[model samples]
Target: MSPSKQGKSQLIDSLYQKAKKLHWKQCEQCRVKKNLFKFVR
Candidate 1:
């Protein structure tokens, strides 16, 4: 309800989105590595 609270909520939401993106990126990298290893073997 207050301006400060609203700002904090927005900051937290932004951080959460960033974290989700990073997690997905890491997952993708792992998948790629796994495929590469499979191909090499």
Candidate 2:
């Protein structure tokens, strides 16, 4: 991959990791409710 493209991919990976953490936290907080909302479509 090109330099710029490689950098973009790395950034995207970190963002995905962060988003995953947020998703888990939200699910835990909403466990009492029957319906769960999606963060990603």
Candidate 3:
């Protein structure tokens, strides 16, 4: 894979892991907002 692609995959994986560590209720709103921003950008 290209270096840029690899970096992006790694970043996504790290974000998924961090999200998994959060309490569901605590993370719900933040996760939605983050995903919205990600999609918008």
- Candidate 3 C-alpha lDDT tens digits along 1-41: 99999999999999998887776767888899999999999
- Residue by residue across 1-41, what tens digits does model 1's lDDT show? 99999999999999999999999999999999999999999
The stretch of ten residues in a row with the least summed lDDT in candidate 2 is 32-41
- The model with the greater lDDT, 1 or 3, is 1
Window of ten residues with lowest summed lDDT in model 1? 1-10
Which scores higher on TM-score, 1 or 3? 1
Error of 3 at 34 (Å): 28
- Whole-model lDDT values for every prediction: 1.00, 0.83, 0.90
RMSD (CA, Å), candidate 1 to true, equals 0.8
| Worst 10 contiguous positions by lDDT, candidate 3 | 18-27
TM-score of each: 0.85, 0.70, 0.54
Provide the lDDT at 17 for model 1.
Answer: 100
The full ranking of all candidates by lDDT, starting with the best, is 1, 3, 2
In angstroms, give how far residue 29 of model 2 lies from its true place. Answer: 0.6
